[model samples]
Target: MFKKVLVANRGEIACRIMKSCQQLNVRTVAVYSTADKDAKFVKMADEAYCVGPAKAQESYLNREGILMAAVISHADAVHPGYGFLAEDALFARMCSQCGLTWLGPQADLISLMGDKAAARKFAASRGIAIIPGTFVLNDPDATERAALKIGFPLLIKASQGGGGKGIRIVTSPDDLNSQLKIAKQETSSAFGSTSIYLERVLKHARHIEVQIIGDQNGRILVLGDRDCTMQVRRQKIIEESPATFITDAQRRELIVTVHRLLDGVNYQGLGTVEFLFSDDRFYFLEMNTRLQVEHGVTETTTGLDIVMLQLQLASNESRLSRQIPSCDGVAIECRINLTAPTNNNQLSTFSFPEGIRVDTGYQSGDNVPSYYDALLVKVIVNGKNRLEAVTLMQKALANIKIDGVSTNLHDLQKILASSWYKKGVFAVETLDMRLEKHESFTG
Candidate 1:
C-alpha cells in the first residue's frame, strides 16, 4: 500500500518492477545515471531523478544520491530491482534509517547471505549438502593446502560477490598461485573485498536453483525450480522452469531441503538457493539475496508476480497469506545481449512474436547505452511441455528482429537446433565448447 516506490537499479528489471507497481496502483520514482536519462524505465516512472555519471560507482551505486532522490520524491519504499545496491546491507540500513521501507530482506540477513564463504559454511551447518570447499584463504601456502585437501580441478572464487566475476579454475598446483593472485585482485576491484575461497569443481553438473519466498511470520513457499545450465563465461543465457531433467523424487527432495534451510533462518522476501547436480546428488552453490535475472521463467510457470509478493512482504500489514499457485506449464527465457559492435546503437525494427512476452529496457530508435550491462531484453515463452516450449521459443526468436544492433539471436537459434541441446545433454561449459568448436572448424 505504498504511495510511491523508487526503483534503485536500471535496465529491464527496473522496467519490469515498474509494471508491477503500476498494476498495484503504486506511483514509481526512477533514479537513473546520465547515461540512462532517457531510458524506457525513466519515461515510465511518475518521477525521475539523475543520480550521477555513467560509471556505476558514481551513479547506480551512489547511496547518498539515491537516498536523496527517495526523500525528495517522498517514496514510501525503495525496491532495488536486482543489482547494484540490491544486496548492499549498509544501503538497506540507510534506507530504514531514512524512514523508507526496504523492499527486500532485512539488513542482517542480507549481510549474512552476501558473504559467499560464510553462506557456504552456513548451508553445510544447516544440513544442506555443500560442495567440499575451504574458508577464506590467507596466503599462497593456505591456497596450496586447500587445493591438495579438496583435490585438483577446483575453483578459486570471491567470497563476497556473485554474477560470475572473480572466479578462476585451476587443474594443477602450477597454476594455483597465478590464478589466486589474479582472483584476489579482481575480487578486490569488483566487490571491495579481497576474501577468497576454494571449492571442488563438478566437471559436468546441471546448475539447478530453487525459487523461495518467505514472510515475516516465518512461512516459506517454494515456487518450483529452474535449470540454468546454459551459460557462457559463467553467466546464464537460457533458463527454464520445471528443470525437465530431475526426477520426481529429486525435485521433492530439493524443495524439502531448501524449505528446511529457509525455515532455520529468519529469511524474508525473495531469494534463490542455487545448487550443482551431479551423480544423483545436489551440492549447494550459493544463495542470491535478491531477485534473479531469470525470474521471468518462474513467473511464467507459476503465474505469480514475485515483485508484488516482495512489496506485500515489506508492507506493514504483511497480508501475504495467499496460497501458492500451482505450476502448470514449462517456461523458457532467452537473454538478448548487445554485442561489442553495437556500442553506439539504434534499434530500427524492434518486434517480437505475438504470443511471446518480451521484457526490454529500450524502445525502437532508443540509443543502447554502453554504460550498463549488455543485456537488452529477455524473451520468455511458455508451453504445455518442454518440446512445445522449445519449439515456441525457436519460432519466437526467428520472428523477432531488432535492426542496427548485433545480438545473439542467431546463436540461440543454432543452439536450439543442436542435437546435444535437444537431448538435454548440455552443461555449464557446453556453449563455450560449441562456440570454440565452430570457430576452429571455420578457421
Candidate 2:
C-alpha cells in the first residue's frame, strides 16, 4: 500500500478519492489551481499545493505542474481522478518513468483504448460486438464514402473522443457534408486530432455501461451495469445501477461479454465498457480507460470501494480468485450542475437537502466558476428497489435549494415524476423531448 498519494484532479471526485485514501490509512496530497485555493478537496487533504493560475492550461491540465507537485510531496503514487490527465497515456508513462505508481491502467492500455477507432477495431478482432463504423478518415471524400456505406443517420465521432465532445449526427447526405466538416473542426480543436470516424447512430438506444475491475494478475470482475440513458444536452444527469430495462439473463450476458472483451485484451485496473442497447442487442460504443463519474451508484449498491481496488491493482497486487461483490439494492445519482437558463456564470451560494448522500467538492460562499465544468455536487440514493430509489431521489432533489445560480434540480425532479422515467422507458433523447415540452414549467 502507498503511504502517500497525490490527487491530480479537482472537484468532488478529488475529494472522494482523498476520503477513500484516508480510510485506507494513506496520506493525500492535493494539487489545486489558484482559483481553488480554498476548495473542499484542498481542505480535506493532508497537504495542498498551488499548481498554477485559474486557466486549465496553466493549472489542472498542466501535466508538468502536477508531476512536480507529486515529486515535491514525495508521494508514492498519483491518482488522476476521472478527468484531466486521468486517461492521458503520456501522463501514465511519465508517472512510470518518474518511478511513481499511476493508480490506473498501464500506458499501453490507455493508448490503445483511448482511440475510439482503434478500440472498435480491436473489439471487432476479439469477437466483441461492435457498432457499424468506419476507420479514421483523413479526406472528406473518404468520409462521404464511409457515410454512404454506414447509411444515413450516422454519427461522425472523433477517434479520441470522450465526454460527448467532438460528435455530430448527420440525418442525410444533404447534412453530411457540412456536419462532417464541422465535426472534424471540433475534433481538431477539442482533441488536437482531426482523425474522425463514422458510426451508425442507434435511434432511441439505451446507454448502458458495465463497470469492471481488473488486476495485474489478469483477474477481471464485472461489478454490474449502469443505465445512463437519462441525459440532457448529451450529458448524463442521472444514473442508476442494474438497469431497469435489462433482464437478469440479459444482464448476465452483458457481464459475460464484458469479461470476454477484457480477457481478450488482458485489461487491467478500473475501466468502463460502454454499449448502445438497441433492438435487444448490445453494440460497443467505446471503453473509458479510467474510473467513471457515475461510479458512486455502483459503490452504493455493492458497498465496494473502487478507489482502494484501483490502488491495490496499481501496486501489482494479486486479485485472482476474488468473487464479484454482490449488490444489495438499487442506487441512483443526480449530478447537480450549476448552470443557468440563458447565461452561464459563477454561483454565489448553494443549499443542499438532508437525509441524502451529497458528495460535493464545493460549499457555501464558494464560487461556481464558469471556467470549468458546471457540476456542483453528486446526490446519490440507495433503496431496496428501483421505485424506492426513484422516490428517494425525487425527495432529495426537492429539498435541494441553490440560490444565485440556476440548476437542473427542478428539471431533474420533473424527470423523476414523468411517466417515461417512472416506467423506465427512456432513451438518449428522452430528456431533451421532456424539457422541450415542459419548457414553461419550472417544476
Among the numbered candidates, top lDDT falls to: 1
Model 2: per-residue Cα lDDT at residue 372? 74
Poorest stretch of ten by lDDT in candidate 1: 434-443
TM-score of 1: 0.96
Q: Assess each prediction's global lDDT (C-alpha) against the native.
A: 0.87, 0.85
Error of 2 at 196 (Å): 1.1
Using all chains and alpha carbons, the TM-scores for the candidates as numbered come to 0.96, 0.95
Residue 312 in candidate 2, Cα distance off native in Å = 3.0
True-structure Cα RMSD, model 2: 2.2
lDDT of 2 by residue, 337-370 (tens): 8766334344565777667778888887777656
Q: How close is each model in CA RMSD to the real structure?
A: 2.0, 2.2
List the pairs of residues colliding in candidate 2: none
Clashes of 2: 0
